[model samples]
Target: MTNRSTAIPQLSWSDVCGRRLDRHGLSAPVRDGTPADAVAAMCGAHAQVLSAAEVSIGLRVAGATRADVADALWRERSLVKTFGPRGTVHLLPTRELPLWTGALSAIPPSSTTMPADARLTPDQTDEVIAAVAAALADAELTIDELSTEVVARTSPWAADPVVPAFGGRWPRWRQAMHLAAHRGALCFGPNRGRKVTYTSPRRWLPGLQPAPAADALAGLVRRYLHAYGPATPQQFAQWLSAPRRWATELFDSLASELEEVEVDGSPAWVRAGDTEPPPTPPHGVQLLPYFDAYTVGCHPRNRLFPGPAAQRALAGGQAGNFPVLLIDGTVAGVWHQRRSRRSLDVTVEPLTPLTVAERRELDDRVERLGQILEEKPQLTIGTVLVGGHA
Candidate 1:
């Protein structure tokens, strides 16, 4: 989406970092907002590890703790856990679930999840989805419980062990689990003991369904642009794990509402009326958890993950594999944490030397992290040998 009629306004990389850090509540993270508001600001929190997702949201708000994020998900019912972007578990603002479901519904289905030989037929997939909805309408159920309910509701073939899992075979109907979540048939419920549970969304928000596709997609584009603008369609596509061509066409359709601009020479687009960069560049040290949305969603990877960060902060150029130490809105190092009964031990591997002031900032970040996690924190600056933070 370009307005090539006149000279395109140019934005510097530093300017982009400054604005993004400010919008993400990281530049001056001492702000006021609920956990759900923080989640909305970041589009959503990648929650494959629920604890990391809680910390991701908690860090964005002033004085917000993991408990606050948990309350929003379980008590207040203001945020929901479901299969979000890329069909990964995420904590999305409950109020925006309809928009998420709508846009996702409009997306063409991606590659199949299971092997071709073991995959369910189209009709069987539909039957499983319907059974899932019907079974979850009133009570929350674990995967095993839901499997039993689904098998009873559908054909016996639905329970056949076809899709291989953690050494064992998963029921054929289980292949449609993410599909059920994406279609708003169900969402994560409070854990029942050590097992996870799923329940229908209708229980909390009656009559909720996907919004009309066209309007919902437009709204989603605007929301995404608001959170991560001055981005390319390819970057947006990569973030959503959607096909590049679909993202390109979506950007083309919203041309009137977007403005193309030059960023360190490369072309990018922002919401039409928003072209000015933040007055101040990003500064200070902040620690980000695994799968933090900012690290996973930002574009122009070379700049966000530069030099040593390219090797330390990312896994083969893919962001979010390692928890990172962000200095001035860019990845600067990698970190690891170990929690005990009384305190959390944190080790940081800095790619760049830290100044006296930066060291103080790092200590402050560790203190705040301890507060959010409800543990005393001990910071160690040395080699971080973790192969996986998750």
Candidate 2:
């Protein structure tokens, strides 16, 4: 079929997000019995789900140790290349660097929270480039090793003791790597002691020249629609942090390719042709990570959490970084757990007064969340109802 004829489905933001993660190869399992594709599929029918986790809760999820978790996230992107998308750092896959960095080169850098004293001058940036090039001519090193090279190469007058600890000089070094990335001089390498290593990109992908800038941007637009389809250009622009002109240009380029849909009475664009519908999630409670893609990717928030309850649960958008209680599809409230002498104490604030059945069901769900976290959850239900913070 040229276009999907089914009615636009009422997918809870959480369910839609979960689907995205599964399709984009961002979910925990690295391989799901499929042969390893050269670089895992970064652009897929459900790309938003991956970016949601990568940008918010981070890419690594189910490893037994923190190091393993961090390593899994690190493989998504070298720390430097990760910052290009959304102009915010993301745990991107190493194989997909070109998709993001290529887009970064087209957008202007916006204001961000990089340490001020760490800023570098143009000449100093050049020095960093020379230093790192010398260090990695044939060698692959972790961020620490690369930082040492940068500190040593910096002039003694420019030296600051805090440079090592605070990376006062590291931004310049990071900039050099970005330059190297742009020139295809740096790329993903084998992991060294838990950190994803980087060597010359040219060396890593010898024949894989990047597509032209216009084509690359177009690819990003297409990928976003496929992954997080039924979205607005405004949403796409915010996700990429692109200028309005560039955003419009990219969308215009794909005029013939996308399909229009009315979601909740708002205009959206979904991919032109995916015949199979996404599977429905089993009804249950889900403890979403703070800043879970489900909450952050969509707009008008009401569709997911209902009313002021969303605001209370979010606590000034701070909720993105913490664990939350998902009752059915919407965020019914917020929850946090603390481990004690023998069990896990989970504090729950329900957005609305729950019926006896709902409370019991929620308790059971919290128990499952505790199981995932490897602890027995002792739930403490809050006295306050919806729209009030605990």
Candidate 3:
């Protein structure tokens, strides 16, 4: 049972993006504006489900802690998930994992998208497992040693004319090691010089068999849309590295629970319900890291940022180079943050001049960010020059 009478309002992309930034405790306006909690009341609360190492990488790049990550894992806040989105891992919240993973499963993996070290015929994989089992029967092996032995045994296969010689890239072997570890045939010996060695499966997730494929895929999809929804099937497809056909199937599966809406004139799918959106703030400024899920979370990209600006921001893949500025509810431009001995320098390059109120609001945000950083409260922040205008 779903209702379509309510036309989903044109949510201010800026508002959603800015609030998202501050919710993560990045930056916010100086005035008596809405806090992240209030703004969460305007748009739906976003879940920080991560599937890839990249999601964590993005968070770490932004200075998040393991505690922050633990909060989102295996819960509604985050789904302990995995798949190829941007050819890396993505962590989605538990609630939304099913649909996104399902959509992702629908997409076939190309050679480029598949892990680098994945060269195993079923028989060869079996052989590798058997070899791994035999090797671990008496002693545990570190990833490096295990990988070395695996290469020796699998070298014959790697040399096959039909095979691509992807024996040592660390992808497939890692997958095999995880399987062996999961199978109780291996356990981790004390952390060996920054790497964990495996003993037998009984040593790790004892007695736990891998979940069914359908179950895993469905779970991934559900989490992705739940956390990053109000997105398009295309965006979902892109996020999952899935094909359009499979994405449609997953979307259709959740059709009753999803609503089609336009975000900034582009079609997007948002969770369906009467749940109130996050509240609006009088003024706002947020410093979002590069590849911040909040920034790349959208499919079309322009819904929250101007296309030109977003593209320019992504021109560089690194995070420290591009710090995003959210003013009001839209991306005003980029802010660059630098660290000094006792203070941090934040420089803003606004796409447009700030109004007197906006500037003051920005100053307050700078103060708050400094407090959070435990650095000097001084901003040392200024706007960038564009066409001789600051």
Candidate 4:
């Protein structure tokens, strides 16, 4: 059991949003330096869609190009791409891999919920995890190659089909891949042609040292609060893909370290001494790429993404399918882009009519996006399809 705090501070919704923008590196972009710096600021940028991850980081760092993000990951070795919170791929700073891995490993595996036929026995699962780590300890290998190695090291059981997915059977061993990544034993390497590859973080990231599990969990929670504070334990749990009880227990353990705050009359938590006034709302409009951290980090969908914006921007409550149009921090519409030869064409559809100024600002933002991609942009203002509606 842990001690709890009672003196909670009250803060407005706008204040929370403003502070989030500042903490998320949206108010003032981090100076162009390393992709690690940008990833660190955002806690970790969603990378399930690699291209979107590039754009997400590019939007927050001045003069950062997609190539720059790639260089940081593949060439400079400053960033490590791996499965993170919620079992989703994320790009994390190489130096912080230990913290992420330590915290992630602390979460008990949920494989027991899988149908018996689809689940690996506990001993089999452990063997598969160790085999994966050993195989990728020094070299990058594609899924097929890694699977072959696992079969050789463990058994045919390691390659047996666990369940059906994407119109085909997913092998039992496949689950171990996500497990390996979460434990920090494996991470994505640059694509080998059309096939993605994986490598060992221990071999790829030199001089890595993971903090103790408890310390790492505490640090991760604090970082989450800093980037997306005034948040509830349920929201935190949702973000981490952890059991509600586990999240609540972790929250209780840190009660003494966190300061209670009210978000729109609801209780939330922030880091102790994080009492600075919220900054002013950011000006102009922004076209946030798919799975942009800001869009995904702030929760309680009803609030951050309210009304028709929800129906249009999200598909079955799942984000990342379409890029979002951010007008003064809140999602206002959805957008898409296409490229042909030299010029890029962009289409934006706002839920409500925009003033001349807002339209102009939107255009400017699109132009900036073009600069980031190093291409000329052609703009088309129109309705964007969302939730099967136009």
Against the hidden reference, what TM-scores do the models get? 0.97, 0.63, 0.59, 0.94
Of candidates 3 and 2, the better by lDDT: 2
List runs of model 2 lying over 4 Å from the truth.
1-84, 87-89, 111-148, 151-212, 274-283, 315-319, 340-343, 355-368, 383-390
Ranking of all candidate structures by their TM-score, best first: 1, 4, 2, 3
Q: For candidate 2, give the lDDT of residue 161.
A: 39
Show where candidate 3 strays beyond 4 Å: 1-84, 89-107, 111-143, 152-211, 274-277, 281-283, 316-321, 340-343, 360-378, 382-390
- Candidate 4 per-residue lDDT over residues 1-390, each given as its tens digit: 222444567787678778878776676667855678889878899987777788888878878888899889988888988898888889999889889988888886653567877777778878988899889888889988998998999988777876667888767888777778877678888789999999888765765555688999999999998988878788888788788888888988988888877777887888887856585755557898888888887876888788998878887886556788887778899998777897989999998899999999888888878877778998899975443321
Better candidate by TM-score, 3 or 4: 4
Model 3 agreement with the true structure over 1-390: per-residue lDDT tens digits: 224688655654544444344444334322332222221211112222221222223222244333434444422233232322544433433333333333333345434444334455556656676667667665667866776666676655533333233563343544444344323244344446777565543232234344455665555555455555556676767654457776777677766777766556656666676223456552455555444555555444554566656654544432222456766545567766565896867777777777888788778666645644556645544554322101
What lDDT is reached at residue 83 by model 1?
Answer: 90
Name the weakest run of 10 consecutive residues (lDDT summed) in model 2: 31-40
Candidate 4 RMSD to the real structure: 2.4
Candidate lDDT values, in order: 0.88, 0.53, 0.49, 0.81
lDDT of 1 by residue, 1-390 (tens): 787776888999888888888888888764768888888889999999887897798788999989888889888999999999988899999898888888877777777667786888889988999999999999999988999999999999998899888989988888888888877898998899999999997775688898888888889888888888889898888988888999999999999988899998999998886888898878989899999998999888889999878877777778888999999988899898999897899999999899999999999999989999989999999999888543
Candidate 4 colliding pairs: none
- The global Cα lDDT (0 to 1) of model 2 is 0.53
Report the error of model 4 at residue 118, Å: 3.2
